[model samples]
Target: MADAPLRSLFQQRFGEAPDLPEILATNPEITRLAARGSCRHFTPDQIDPAILETLCAAALCAPSKSDLQQRDILIVTDPGLLRDLKSLLDAQEWIADAPAMVVFLANNRRQRQLQAWHAQPFPNDHLDAFFNASLDAGIALAFFMIAAEAAGLGCCPISTIRNHLKEVRGLLDLPDHVFPVAGMAVGHPLRAPEISARLPLAKTVHHNQFADITKEEVSAYDTRRLAGADGPGWSEAKAKMYASPQRMDFADVIREIGFKLD
Candidate 1:
């Protein structure tokens, strides 16, 4: 839009910038999706149950580890329950505005139950089961987000579901081997989000072996990202925020959830 070289740079950095003719002729359904990113603000309009089911079906179509199919999705529609969940998850206010919320669970319990029902030994109760369940659930969540966005919905993932692990499980009445991996808030976006900058492909994409990124590469990215209002930019903001000692304590939470992931 500025100059040919700048347009080329835009294409290289992001995928492409639409021309005027393209914008007038093109259907934004797919074109807009290519520029997809997160939206934190959402409209309070309720999403239809039929559309939500379709999104869940699309999510279930995601690839699973060895086709074990251990992931489960739980939809939360009750306002009171949502309030409780919000309080448990550090009261992220955006969540309260979402008309639909989903909890993705890593469900190892079902397999163990099947093994027991079939009168099998079921002795493989080590770390792999837990890891596989979590991995599968995570993949499903990714698919769900993409599918929801394509369906004209916005989604934000809340990992703070891990913060009150026991309370979440108790509230959901979960079994022993099932774990709450992540929560997703879904609704119509109140406003479109600006595309966030990503590091150049050369920094991320490796030809054969893993390529190392240098300080120079990071500096270039910082400059590219900060050309916005109130941006000390992505890298600096992240660095300053995480520079302080942060306590994630994920291991302890997993252990309490009956995952002996040594």
Candidate 2:
């Protein structure tokens, strides 16, 4: 039998059982700490500076591409600055209350400067540099979240920060070849959030090749998701989100930040 917490977490995530390695079923730490729910409500308490520093260090330890270490993190602590950031995000009042805010950046400028200093031929001027830096930042963000959760801190990633990229860049005084990937709000949770359901593993995981998702799978997932919520299901929610164009000019923003997609 699976461990109680693991089984419960599996049910909360997928609304069903999880087939997994036997080791996972028995490991207490993995069963207890592997699941995460986004927390928006936070207490008035502030995160310890030492703890935040340790978490940042742990996050930076995540793998890098060719040892380039292209990820950068900015810890935003100034109340005035945080309020300014919150102002940029419309309707997200929760951000104003969070005790800590950190911005993750994909940094390509370091490598360009390195090439200039070494007088080496800088051949990688295409989309790959942008892709690698963005991916590295994403991985580092994931590591940060894991470390934060393990430390009993709650976090919510604010991707909407991208919507105001120009304003963010100006506010942070970011130079060329550095762009914001995401912002994370960290603090103690006022209340534990409900676990969100996910699409079944079969719909996402493929044996050896890419598998097509049938309408039946989508319908089933929608049904499972709607059982505990009042809003539209995943498919309808996604459709509605995409039906209205969002950040159509993000490409332009990327170009403005000195990243060449081509």
Candidate 3:
């Protein structure tokens, strides 16, 4: 049976009783931890250096493609550099206050260097290499967030860092074939954030074939999300958010950084 906290978290997530698997019901602690929301507001306390290293180690433990280990984590500790990086993100002002910031890089250069060192031909220079590195970095980012949250730290992913890709690459002194995948801000939370509601399993999950989301499902999700909040529903909010083009020129940036999308 799920513990009280796990049950409560499930209720918050689905707006009803949870029908969890036996494994989850038996291990309620993991379920509770996984259910926590992303925290944006953080306190002034700095994350300890040792704990930060441990979190990075945990992140590195994530699976890599063919054990190529194409992901690199750059911990931003320099005050001036951090300030300059924060300036690039005017929309995410809270990043300026984050005690710890990390940049996750998709490093294809390392593998290429390794191939050259072994006198091996680097045949895969196209999109597959780029895709592998990006996917590896993304996996590492997720692991880092999981580890940080488990250690009682708050983490907020900053994908907007891509908007200033060239500036960030210059600031970080990243070479060609080493692209910034994402940034994360970590610190202790000032207050716990509410768990954001997710779509029902029936709407999201599929049996064997892919399923299309119906208008009724979107309407139901919107009603459920706007129960007490004052704003547009999920569909409307996302529509407004994407009404204007965002990061449309990122492809040019990627190509400039030596990634061949073709």
Candidate 4:
């Protein structure tokens, strides 16, 4: 049998593609998932608030860990407020053009409040509390992006919001334990997003036992990335990014925000 178009997309994204014929029954959602990319350029067509609200509702319907429901979404509607927030992200030029933006949050405050309401002591102050909330936020973010793309909107996830955590929290009026995981730029697409390269499934997906990646595997992957429009090889680009201390103080900021990451 001929390889599915989804397999072609996977090959485009990862260089090496997995052949899973049994699961190759393609659908609209599967096609979108297979061809997903981060859209940076956007047209200035204004988004309807109702559409964004529906997207958020669909996103939040995603599975929560033990139904803790720690994730939330905040839409940026005010032009002036969004402008101020955009000022902090001047490095990203596309922010000025995107018609709408939303911030995904890890809101563990509600869970803690449940304890206060029930007159029960909140004993689990370990790292898992913070980890789980952050994970939930990420899951919702993924869902939101998928839904947005499906709805014919482009999206660019702005993780740099964490670089200005204190300012973002102040600007958005985020209270304790309700931290921004990431922000998304949403609007009509000016151009189609390029399929980003990913590490091959061989290095990423393992059998029952977990395995470490080999340097040769990474170098080969880096070579594949270099052959594309990306200027630097994957290893060199990532090494450069790691060299610059972008968010080393992130833990300190989150720690101050009432996450007892013990």
Tens digit per residue, CA lDDT, model 3, 1-262: 4466676776667665456666676584577564878888999998888898999999999999999999999998788998888889868777877888999999999999999999999888899999999999999999999999889999988999988899999999999999889999999999987788877767566789989989998888788878868878989989988898888988898888788898
lDDT of 1 by residue, 1-262 (tens): 3244444434545444435354433445444554677878998799998888899899999999989899999988788887788777655777767788899999988888888899988777778988999999999999999999989899989887987777898888888888889999899999986677777767676788998989888877777777646658667888897897543676776776677775
- Per candidate, the number of residue pairs that clash is 0, 0, 0, 0
Q: Kindly indicate the candidate among 2 and 3 with the higher lDDT.
A: 2
Q: State candidate 3's TM-score.
A: 0.94
lDDT of 4 by residue, 1-262 (tens): 4447777888888896776555564665676788888888888789999999999999999989999999999999799999999999999887888888999999899999999999999998779989999999999999999999999999989999999999999999999999999999999999889998899898799999998998898988988877756588888878998897788889999899888777
Task: Candidate 3: give its CA RMSD in angstroms.
Answer: 1.6
lDDT-superior candidate, 2 or 4? 4
Better candidate by lDDT, 3 or 4: 4
Measured by lDDT, the strongest candidate is: 4
From the highest TM-score down, the ranking of the candidates is 2, 4, 3, 1
The C-alpha stretches of model 4 lying farther than 4 A from their native spots are 1-3, 228-230
Query: Which candidate do you rate higher for lDDT, 1 or 2?
Result: 2
Clashing pairs in 2: none
Candidate 3 regions off by >4 Å? 1-4, 16-18
By lDDT: ranked, best first: 4, 2, 3, 1
In order, candidate lDDTs are 0.80, 0.88, 0.87, 0.89
Task: Return the clash pairs for model 3, or none.
Answer: none
Model 4 has an lDDT value of 0.89
In angstroms, the error of model 4 at 179 is 0.9
What are the runs in model 1 whose C-alpha is more than 4 Å off? 1-33, 244-248
Most TM-score-accurate candidate: 2
